[model samples]
Target: MANRCLICDKKKQVGVSSRHHRGVAGKQWMKRAQKTKRTFSPNLQWATVDGIRIRVCAKCLKLIKKEQPKGNLPEIASK
Candidate 1:
């Protein structure tokens, strides 16, 4: 698995480490918080959506709301 943020596409980074008493010591490897690749629904998992594998974001997963139809029609009124 690659070290990358699925949402923002942030990449892994390396930084220097230092101690309280001692000065800069050595380089330390760091990576962005990773999101689990797998999910409860395999069909929804993706890396790209432009006709390819794409990871679905939380906002996209939100349930779509249905709006009530305007102008009561006679056909619908009977029902």
Candidate 2:
């Protein structure tokens, strides 16, 4: 399955991380900082829309709930 949200088209995002050392003179120095690979994925859930099952993010699901009076996830409107 695709690691994405169909309702909002959300996908995984890559990021980095690093660290620094504190200097003796009350200062911080980047002596040897390294970048690390990381992924940020949205909170997704299985939802049925228009008789089709699709991966929808939690945020979108919340919005759908607000927009829908029946509290049922109908056909997800596309952009």
Q: What overall lDDT goes with each candidate model?
A: 0.33, 0.73
Candidate 1 residues lying further than 4 Å off, grouped into runs, are: 22-79
Candidate achieving the largest lDDT:
2
| Model 2 residue 13 distance off true place after TM-score fit, in angstroms | 0.9
Clashes of each: 7, 0
lDDT of 1: 0.33
TM-score of 2: 0.65
Badly placed stretches (over 4 Å) of model 2 are 24-30, 70-79
lDDT of 2 by residue, 1-79 (tens): 8888877688999988666654555443435466788898889998766567678899887777676677565455453
